[model samples]
Target: MSVNSESVAKKIKELPHIFVILFCVIVLSAIATYIIPAGQYTRVMDEGIKRMVIDPTSFRYIPNTPVGPFAMFVAIELGLIEAANITFLIFAAFSCLYLMEKTGAVDASIALMVNKTKKNPKFSIGLIVVLMIILAVWGSTGTLSYEEIIAFAPIFVALSIALGYDAITGVAISVVPVGIGFASATVNPFTIGVAQTIAELPVFSGLGYRCAVLVVMTTFTIVYVMRYASMVKKDPSKSLVSGIDYSDFTIDDARMSTPFTFQRKLSMLTLFVGVCVMGYGLIFLKWYINQVAAIFMIVSVIVGIINRWSANRIANTLCEGLSKGVLAALIVGVARGILVVITQGNILDTIIHSCVGVLQHLSLHVSAIGMLVFQNLLNFLIPSGSGQAAVSMPIMTPIADLIHMNRQIAVLIFQFGDGFSNLLWPTSFMVIVCAMVRIPLSRYYRWIIPFYAICFLLQAAFILGAVAINYGPF
Candidate 1:
């Protein structure tokens, strides 16, 4: 090829990696800090929730907060500190999961299942539904954060391949279900709980509607996944990843028929019981990242003892898992760094205020739609559901009251806005999953945009319905 052609070819062949994308975002956010005015809302303590909330009306310009070049680097450092919990959990949880894999218990279990149902497409569909339900419940309970879900991705991918499907199918059954449940969670404390309390409503009081949303969303996700899986199974050429080689990672009968030994059974049981305990702690004890990390540590030790593996073997497995998780951990910190830049610049609330300004003096229906769109846009900068709630709800709640719109509808709008878009945005968990599965972001974006559109329309209908019924406890 000629020099110009070679340059063009290289440019076409190289897609921007996650690091490149996040770095650009970081730089853009830094520039925004300089351009966007700094402002703050006075925060008052909400005694009921034990957290401070923004006094929406108290906005004032705070001079001299714009990020300088040096401060941008400092923001990245601070972002790592802010993201420490998630990063550590990803490393530790994946370490434990890797330790479990060393025992061959999970693999054996999957293999056994595959051997039993490899011939039956119906059985494969059933497994997909079951896995979706399990993930959905985990998300609904608010225990499964992005890092926690990473540990499950490889297992589901292996299972999907074993059952004659692609890695995308694996992701659909694993991460997608969790996202669906999160978007429509009936009892998720992080999103629903926080938003409701901020709205001055009883916590988890409007469950009848949330439960309905959950069922509908979960069912849609399952059917969508199965249809894709069915197509890929019938014609492997139809797979999105058909051109990509997955030979080394694919599972077959020989791997499956490997004996499910007594030690392996014990190890598997240890993992199962650990998860149950973790779930209980998450709901009843209000466990956070630290508690979940401790649970994984305990389970790793138990699995090692059950397998009679040497300390060195356990240590080596842990190191390997941590190594694999490093990219994801870095991504989380980088994403948080972008938020830090925006926050320190004081532009986050300014952006929120601007969005709210657009909806003011509009009809309640238009304002509700505007709020949903605003939340969706804000999520790109503040990806954390609870974090977004703390910042946005204080403002949104009173706006609802002013317009004579139900606060419950406001919370419901927040729920949908904070969620469904999570999968579409680059700054959210989509990058983590794309990294985990080795799918290029460009392809995943193209494939998922259609699905996002469908979900968004459904969400709009729900918001309008809530408005019509004045859905609320107040």
Candidate 2:
């Protein structure tokens, strides 16, 4: 592409038009409600329908209401809540990241990496890719922050700059790889674990399938990010510039004169041990993950104070970082708002009831595949893997058993539907993360679309083939 074309692409990549896209989706859905005649069982509920306009105050209720012009109001309401929750978490994560930076620990680590990578540039890329896979595997074990952009973002930026790539490439690689890991995770606390547990299946029972998906998705993410980075390296104009230079990220110009002190080393050890313990509590001991985050945050703060850092400075840094984090968080609300509007307008119910009604008519043999397809389609509306699992599993599991469909296959259907769509969904948390890092949705789609398409087909084929081969959970 020419310089002007690359500049245009960069601008398009940074377009913060989620709200506008959502507005259009709401309009299209509303039009569909009328133009696409409702199937026999898909009747809209007038009483549930609430009409309102999109605004800060009303966006939170959008996801729960019925479909129509009024449904837009509901979307706005629900969007607000989703945005708020994500924003809060991001703020908290950024606070932790800032503390890590302030203590000079982050710098020291970077120096070690730079020294190592300076010996071999290709080794650096390989190391980053490997780390991404490791972090992803850790994520699968139901450990580590699924939302790790704050920690990884700066590191990747520094690495990219060090490697002679632009900041955008760093941000893209940092967020995308981990996101694919989360999406493909079989043992993720939020989705797979929760879904399987709810279905009464053994925890981590489908490890083989999940691992296969994870490997495929992770390879896809790494290849795409590396290619994008190469493109930006070849032509800087292709990279989005935030008007910030590499030096702006420097925590301190002076390198650590003293060797790693016992205190600093001790502090690092404590943080590592604490995190591992917290993960143990969360996964094996049945402790809540939020509780783990809270404890870790508290411990990190204590470590900061003990390291002789000024409390006031730490607080200010955290606040500054959090403000940036909140901007990224708001996109979640915009996406969720679309769902709220549709639900409020009763269109979601109309669609679901219609699908179920149709399923009732199909022969049991076909119904199995039909239900799987139906669940995947619903993922478009409900992008949250956990929320979708919660809502769908209860309704689909018994039906699967009743129709003699393998329950394991039914569960896999939910997993595939939830996992794969995450890559493409505009509203998913991972997708918003990509946008926040200025990785154009179109660019992401360009690279991963083929991989995801293949994965989807493979998953569908696997499910159907299982049925054909008389594969049963027993």
Candidate 3:
């Protein structure tokens, strides 16, 4: 073990922890603000989209708005402020989770699921596919944001391990479907909704084609995950985290026989009712995190009462859950800081403008592909779906028109670009979810590389097919 050999070996195995990785990207992004020239486009309000949209013809070179080194430090606080809704909801959701866990409801549910998986393994496999589809529906049609999956990640991971599979299998069933759904967004308000409205196409007008895409991608993802799960189950050594302890997740006959008591059932019902109320408000009242957070607070109190917990006991349990999630939630804010730096420097438009310059020279085929690749890269800088839409779509819409590409196809390209690398990118929810479930980003990346490669192939076919068929009525 000479010094050089040891260094080489260390390089082979060592990747920075997730926080260090995100912070390094942040510093680099802040530095980029000084290097990349700052520029701007006029943002006039559009009544239809109900937001300020870029005026493509109004692009102009502006004086640099570089964030100072001290300002870069300040942006972390600003980033948390900008991301307050998500950060607050993280606390609320975790509190509710802890409230449920204390009442024996959480273990009872897992115990029951394990019992069923033992009796009917094939049915359990089918259940994975079904679960992915359900999540995809929520992601595709509604405003399912990244960190929103926090409530379900642990449960699914525990369930997957209990079923003799691995942690990645749990993510495959839970997070991957949502990511794919976002990539193939059929009616997602954040991506399609904003993009379509900006393009002046009817909102959700191309539902039929998008739904077909959702089906194809969803099917492929299910097969990919199932194959992996089957392999890991048969040879436990193949599991990425095979050496990991899952003390809280594993169960035995005594645990399996844990009674489904009446109090536990009521606790579960109370939580379900809270979710139902949130859904109603989301669809009809157009609610977001603020509304969802309020509902969870109410639910936690009811859950405490239903289980006959003293007020102090309820408070303690709620705080316990909140403590478990601070790391995960702060990751979201730290990631948000990267976007804040980019925004503070006013370099976001400059980045988009520079890419558009390169794109303008390519042939129609290459231009379409370029847009997809560019969007994927840009997501590293701007992780907010609607925010990306607001910034990118106005520029892209005219690009579509100039090249005789359908606006719908342009929208699809943006959708694919914005979503496919979500979990792969350190700045996105992938880091948060991986942290929450105790999976290392490097290991998760190894597992996901193949999945992302196949996803790109699928994206290429769908984008090209849409071009061939002129995938639009408008």
Per-prediction TM-score to the true structure, in the order listed:
0.95, 0.76, 0.95
Per residue, candidate 1 scores C-alpha lDDT tens digits across 1-474 of: 899998897567546999898888899999998888887788898886788789989988788488888988888889889999888888888889888876778789888888778566478778778889988867876777565776778888888888889888888889888888888868889999999999989998788988888888888788777888889999999987776777655766567777899999888888889888888998899888888888898999889878888889888888988987888888889888999898888888788777777777889898988888888898898888988898889999989999999999999999999988998998887788788778777767756888888888889888998899989973
Model 2 TM-score (2 dp): 0.76
Maximum-lDDT candidate: 3
Off by over 4 Å in 3: 1-12, 252-254
lDDT minimum window of 10 residues, candidate 3 = 142-151
lDDT of 1 at 403: 93
**Model 3, span 1-474: residue lDDT tens:** 899998898567657778788778878988998899998899999888788989998877789888888998888888888888898898998888877877889888888877888788787888888889988877786655565676678878988988889888988899889888877788787788889999988988888988999999899989889999999999999998776677776766667787889998888888888888886787788888899999889999999998888999999999899997898788888888988899899898898889999998888888988898998898888887888888889999999999999999998888898888896788888888888787877779888998898888888888889988989844
- Which regions of candidate 1 fall more than 4 Å away from where they truly are? 1-14
State model 3's lDDT.
0.85
Q: Would you give me the overall lDDT of model 1?
A: 0.84
* TM-score winner between candidates 2 and 3: 3
TM-score of 3: 0.95
Task: List the RMSD of every prediction in angstroms.
Answer: 2.2, 7.2, 2.2
